[model samples]
Structures are given as C-alpha cells and as structure tokens.
Target: MTIGLDMMGGDFAPLEAVKGLQLYLSEPGAPANIFLLGDEAILRPLLATHMIPEDRIRVVHAPEVIGMHEHPTKALKEKQQSSIAVGFYLLSQGKIDAFISAGNTGAMLVGAHYSLKTIEGVMRPTISTIIPREDGRTGLLLDVGLNADCKPEHLNQFAVLGSLYARHILGIQQPRVGLINIGEEEGKGNILAQASYPLLKENNRIHFIGNVEGRDVLADKADVMVCEGFTGNIILKLAESFYEMTHRHSIRHEYLDRFNFEHYGGTPVLGINKPVIIGHGISRAPAFKNMLKLAAKMVKSDLFDQMQIAFRN
Candidate 1:
C-alpha cells in the first residue's frame, strides 16, 4: 500500500524524518510506495547523503513551510504549497493510503480536517495517544490535542473509536472503556463527564468502566480512556516529562524506555474519512517510519470501515 510521509513540518525538519524513513525502508518488507512530501531539492540530497535507495522513495516538492506559530485555517488556505497542505491534498486525491507528518499540529489538523474530512456522523476527529502500560501492554487515550471543548456526544464517539483502536492495534478484546473525570464516583466530574457517563453506560457496544482518574491510568484500570482535548493533552505532555525523568534516574531498567512515543511512532487522527497519522513535532526518520508502519496496519485492519459500521449503529 502507498503511505505518504511528510519529510518537512517537524521541529527537526527533514533530517529526523529522513532517518525515520530509512529505518522503515530498511525493514524486510518496506511499504510498496513511499511518497515523501517537501522540497525535493532538500530531501533528495539527504537521501543520497545517507546512501538510501532513491528508487524506493518518491519526492513531491512542497516549497512553503508552515511555521509552528501560524494559524492552521489561515495557513492552509493561503500557503497552498506548504508541506501540511500538500500532504492533505495528496491524501484526499487517493494518491496515498495514509499520510504522516511531524509538522505544525494545528495546521496539520486543520488541513486534514478540511481536505480529507471526517467520517459521516463523527462530531470531530481526535488525535488518539497510546502509552505503553507498566504491564508490558498499552492503553488508549483520545482527544490528545485535537478538540479542547467537547460535548457528551463527542465523548461517546471518542469512546467507540478508542475501544476499536485498542482491540485492533493493542490486542485488547472487549476493551474496557472509561471517562477521565475528577473522581471515580459516578457523579464526580463536571457537566460534560456527568452527561457523558450515562451515554457510555447505556451503550452496550463497549465495556464501560465508569469513571477513571488520571493516576489510575497506568494501574491498568481502563483500556480506553476518553477526555476532552484540553485534559488529554495535558495528561500526555506531563507523562512525557515523567517518563523522561524516570529514564534519567535509572537507565538500567529497560522498562522505562518502553514509555517513549517513538515506539508507537505517533498519534492517529481519528474520525477522518481517510487515515492520517500525526507525528511528534521533533520526529526523525525512525519515528516517521514507525508512523507509516502503524498506518499500514490501520489499513490492513480496515479501521475506517470498522469505524463506519461502529458509528452507523
């Protein structure tokens, strides 16, 4: 399958993204097609510099680079040649099965939302994050950084998506889902969580685990955790710092390394009609490669099709 990789748009730019590509291409069975978007002039030389196989990679020249600070909606419309926009355009045109970028997240989200669009009946697309659990497995968290303010219906949809993701990628059967709230009590969180609780409980599709607090996440209390973007993003960022701290304190324990985002490659943008994976801003080649690998699996699993069925019912 064709997997589009955005060579630009990250904090480390083309260099790290190239490294990720190399890692993927070096695998025994690399993707059939690797469409790299960004300035071909800058990207081609880098491939040659690393002595990577040029024939395996396709370069699409995207001259305009969207700054991290630029507004997503404005940049997408004005900067037609920007890496994020180009990636989205190619995805929409069916030139690629999936798209991965380590660029400006807001711009990427905005571009992907408008260009590729979301599944019908999907309130909004959430960037789902998965963190390796202490038990040698992983759990799913949604709205990582996509939508801050959400309604009860939005949270309900996220639960469905998160559960399906866990079951497919993480190998969790009948994944137990929960709402990230202030307290474990049924009536704990604000109006949103309180309102969403009943909907999730009523829905027999998922294994509802009532309310799950932030601290209980690593305890394996829930397989799928749902929250608004504001809450989920904060939890994700804080976990990053904590994971780094644990690594520095004792490098001997190999388990601490499992918490890294590089292993998962990147977050998957849910609710989109087509699969679009968003990498970390500072992602490199290995990370990008992993992102594409994840995308390919999503396609093989028919994730979007499954989502259509899940939401349709």
Candidate 2:
C-alpha cells in the first residue's frame, strides 16, 4: 500500500516530515511506501541529508503550498499545483491508498468532501478525536468541529459512525455509545439532546448507554460520545488545554502525558470513502510517524469497507 504524506503541511515542513519518515522506517513491520508531496528541490536534499532510503519511498513534487490562513475553497481552486491539491488528486485517482496532512484543516476537509465519495446512507461525514479515559481505556468523540450545527438524525448517525470507529480502529468491541448532554436522565438536556436520546436508544446499529454528562467524558462511562460540533469542539479544546496547562506549570504524570496529541498523532475524517488523516499543524516527527501508522492500520483493516457495509444495513 502507498500512503501519501504532505511534506509541506506542518509548521516545520519537510524537515519534521523527513525526521518522521526516519522514525517510521526504523520501526519493524512499518507498512506502506511513503509518498512525499512537496517541492522536489527542497525535499531531495533533506531526504538525502537524513539518509532516507530512496527505494522505500517516492517523491511527487508539488511546487506550491496552501498557506495555513488561506481560505480553504479559494486556496484549493486557485493553487492547483499546491501540495494539498495534488495530494487530493492522487488520492481521488487511486494513486495513494490514504493521505496524511497537518496543513490547513479547512482545506483538508473541503478537499475530502469534494474529492472523495461519502459512504452510502451517511448523511454527513464527521471528524472524531480519541478521548483518553481515566481508567486507562480510550474512547471516541465525534463531530468535534465538523458540521457544527446538526439535526437529531445527524447525531444518531454519528453514534453509529463513532461506534464502528471505536471497534475497528480503537480495538473496542461492542463499544458503548453515549450522547453528551447536561444530565444523565433520558429526557434531560437541550432540544437536540432530548430529541437525539430516543433515536440513539432506538438505533440498533450501536450499543447506546443513555446520556453522558460533561464530567463523564474522561471517566470511561461511554466508549463513544456523540454531540454536535459546537459542544464537542469545546470539550476537545478543554481537554487539550489540560495537557498544555500541566506542562506550563511543570506538572508531570503518566496520565497527563496521554493528553499529548502526539501520542495519537491525528484524527481521521471519518465516514469518507478513503482514509484521510489530519494532524496538528504543530506536529513534529513522532506525530507524523504515528499518522503514517494510523493510515496503514485504517487501510489494512479495510475500515471504509466495514463502514460502508454497516451504513448500508
């Protein structure tokens, strides 16, 4: 399998990406041939300096790059030669099994939507983050920032999507689904929560466990938390800050280390036809390596096929 890497996307471009490739190559059973997408003039020297094995990889020179602040739609349309655009082109044409990037997130999402097909029966493709639970197990949270406003049916579908992801990617079987809400009772919370409760409870596709309050997120009360992007993003950001704040104060602990985004690498734009992993803009070597690992796992697992079958049923 060939996995495309956006060598120009992250804050520390080609450099960190090269270093990450080194890390990935050193590991045993590292699957997928790396496809580097960026300026050939710059990438060639860097790859040589880093002593990257040429036979294990291929470089697709993309002369342009989409700036982080550029408008997603506009940058993609105007910068046809940009790394992100070319990466999408390769993916759409089946040249790459999956694509990984830490660049303009808006551009990545926009490209995925337009360039790839959505699974049949999926209302909207959602993005999810891995939630580190207090009990040492991990959970999944969906619609973190995509589809900020969603219908009750959207939340219901997210439950199914999140559950399937947890099972296939996170290695959780019969993953319990929960709706993020203000209360634990079935009829509690906002209009969206209240309306979504019955649907989740009724949905046979997932193992629904009723509502999970804000405090229940990290407690392992649920394996898949479903919510609209507005609330899910807030929870995601707040959790992210815990790691940042702890490091700022010189607090160290194994538990806090789990909050580091590098450990998980990045989140996949779930529900899409092909695997597209988006990394943190500030991602370094470790994060990039993990992203490659994730893309490989997703492909080897035939994740999208399982998702398509689930949705079709």
Q: By TM-score, how accurate is candidate 1?
A: 0.95
TM-score of each: 0.95, 0.98
Candidate 2 TM-score to native:
0.98
> What are the clashing pairs of model 1?
9-103, 16-284, 16-285, 19-285, 19-286, 20-285, 20-286
What candidate 2 gets wrong by more than 4 Å, as runs, is: none
lDDT of 2 by residue, 65-178 (tens): 999999999999999999999999999999999999999999999999999999999999999999888898888999899989999999999998888888888899899999
Give the CA lDDT, 0 to 100, for residue 276 in model 1. 85
Model 2: lDDT of residue 11: 94
